[model samples]
Target: MTFYDRDQELDALRTSFESPECGFYVVYGRRRVGKTALLKEFCADRPHIYFLAAQEAEARQREKFIEKIAEHFDDRVPRIGGWDEAFDYLGEKLATEQLVLVIDEFPYLVAENDSLPSYLQSFIDEQLQNTDSMLVLCGSSISTMESDVLGHESPLYGRRTGQIDLQPFSFQQAREVIGYDIEDAIRSYAVTGGTPMYLTLFDYDLPLGENIRTQMLSPTAVLYNEPEFLLQSELRNPARYMSILEAVATGHTTPNEIAGATGIDSGPLSKYLQTLRRLRLIDRAVPVTASAKQSKRSRYRVADEFLRFWFRFVEPNRSSIEEAPKVVFDGTIEPTLPDHVAPTFEDVCEEVVWEKIRRGELAPYSEVGRWWYGEHEIDIVGLAPDDDRILLAECKWTSDPVGHSVASQLREKAPHVRWGPETREEEFALFSKSGFVDGLADDLTDDWSLIDLTEVDVCLS
Candidate 1:
């Protein structure tokens, strides 16, 4: 597949490569997120040696690493036995030529040899940094990479000159990859959620329903075990994490609600939730107006859209799919798929608004997120404390044209958000999937902005 986004990331790598000094770069993210693809693209035209470690014993890994280096440097170099000899040869070879040595899946190597980071740190300090070679240590294990490679207490803490914590693609990038219209693109994104690997598996020419049935719901499909495989790879106890994720996916956002749903005690649940948050699998959200430290009304949500859809729809409906695929699609998935995409649509709209703010097309809001109080809720809120300004927005995913009532309701709820003692000036923005009703624009004040699906497409473009 052709590379999509990552222009900024590629630039980062290029800058490091062109520098006068050696560079030790760290690249890490969840599995199947295109980490290897990015590194290959970066190393395509350069003199580079890429070693992808496997889940094997330490001795086997060392042999493979030596073989890769020996092949790169040719038979002129002596056969190295271990990392110490390998780094010694690498430092000597780097002095003669500019090279990039990418150790993909570095955590796998660390799992077998716990002292690999210490060896790399010494090599980098003594020899690698003295030359123009760039050492890129990449991994998919979020916890291990963060703690052992980037954490403060790790042996290689201060050795890294640059790092990139690559995330899944955004809706815009995913849309470009899917090459579909606004409606079908939204549906695809609701399921794939910006993951390039998942998006590439779907056939865009076919009906979205059929694509979902084959690519996701089928028991024999490749993606059937994707979420489980990812969880097992990154998590210590996949069952406990799966339960917590299922709880969040089923609308159990609060701690007490998740506890009730999963039957796990609050103490251990907190630890699991923190670990999941650190892995970028789930997020803890508070109201836009509430302080993070002081708010007791925080809610947990699955950060990965695909995982959310899997836990909510696929995993729960396995028996139904196994019995009859068509029946499951027509009876369960087709009917409730929109409900699954509703929250995701809101997220997409919020991202568009943030993009506008980044381009100076919107107000200078300090914070942007969803807000709610008791029974009332707002889809998007942007706060600017210094300027005493607030932006209240509503995102509607329905096909029906949104009328003035929705904007009126947003206006009604703008005052309920308590930012400070003094009243703040308010602005309104409305994002609708099917555009707005007739004459809806005439009522718009100077402070209000109306953005429909077409506008979002253009913003993404």
Candidate 2:
């Protein structure tokens, strides 16, 4: 698939390359997030040597690394005794000529030779720092990358000239990649999230449901077992983490609720949750009005849209899906897809609000997130504490057109959000899937906005 975004990342890399001194850059992210792709794109026009490491013996990896260097330099490479010798060889070449040496999956090399980071550190301090060449260390293992390379105690600390923590695409970028209508794009994003690999699997010629059946529900498809495969590869124990994720995906958001649902004791649950959060698979959300550190009402949510969809629909009905994929999707998935897409729709609406803020259509806000207290809940809230102003919004995904009652309910819930003073300014917005009633337009003012699905798409575009 074609690369859709990463203009900022490309610009950062270009700036580093244009520098006069040597460059040591670290790039890391989760699997299938396009780290390798981005690097390949950046190196397409530059003189570079790219080596992909694997989970093999240190000697074998070193041999392969030398072979890649020989191919790039167009010379017969000498045999190296150790990683230090390997870096020494590269350092000699880099001292005279400029080249980009990228070691993809650097964690795999560290797994075999634990002192690789120390050798590289010595190489940088002793040789590469004086040259005009560049070295890029890329990895998919977030934990190893952090603890071994980017951590304070690591020998390679303070040596990197730049770093890129690459992330998945946003809703708008994903929509552009899928080339679907607004509603179908929302559903596709709910299934594929923003992962480029998954988005590429979706054939634009097919409808969303057909794509789900052929590309997701089929037992042989890549996405069918992706969540399980990722968990097993990343965690030592996948079962416990899987249970916690399932609980969160199924609406058991609070710690107590998750503990009760997963049958795990509360004592050990925090560790598991923290691990999941570090992996970027789950997020902990608190009320917009409360401090995250002090909020007791924090709720855990599955961060990846695809994982949430899989745990909610695929994991539970695997047996039935194997028997009849079409029936399962038509009967089970299709009927409840709207409900499944509602939360993601709210997320898209929030993105629209952020766009409005960026374009100066709305006032700048310090923090923007969902706000909830007791029985009152607001779908989207933007708090501008300095200006003594608040933006409250209600997002409705139902088929019926939103009426004055929805706006009235949002107004009623506004006072419960104890953010600013009683005399502070308040702005309201209502996002609807089926548009709004004609009479509701009379409520529009300088402080009030009614946004429909079309407007949401346009604002984001």
Best by TM-score: 2
The local distance difference test score of each candidate is: 0.89, 0.91
Candidate 2: segments with Cα more than 4 A from true spot:
none
Alpha-carbon runs more than 4 Å astray in model 1:
76-81, 421-423
Residues 1-461 of candidate 1 have per-residue lDDT tens digits of 78878889999999999999999999999888889999999999999999999999988888888778778878454666788887887787788889899999999999998889988988999999789889999999888899999999899998888999998988877877886898779888998887888888888888888788899888889888888888887766799899899989989999999999999999999998998998899999999999888999899999988899889988888888888889978887789888899899899988898899989999889899999999889999998988899899999988799998998889888778887546678889999888999999998889989998899998877
User: Model 2, 302-376: lDDT tens per residue?
Assistant: 998999999999998999999998888989998998888999999998899899999998999888999898888
Task: Give the TM-score (vs. native) of candidate 1.
Answer: 0.97
Q: What root-mean-square deviation over C-alphas does model 2 reach?
A: 1.0
RMSD of each: 1.4, 1.0
TM-score of each: 0.97, 0.98
- Give the Å error, residue 445, model 2: 3.5
What C-alpha lDDT, on a 0 to 100 scale, does residue 230 get in candidate 2? Answer: 95
Q: What is residue 104's positional error in candidate 2, in angstroms?
A: 0.7
lDDT of 2 at 435: 95
- Model 2 poorest 10 in a row by lDDT: 438-447
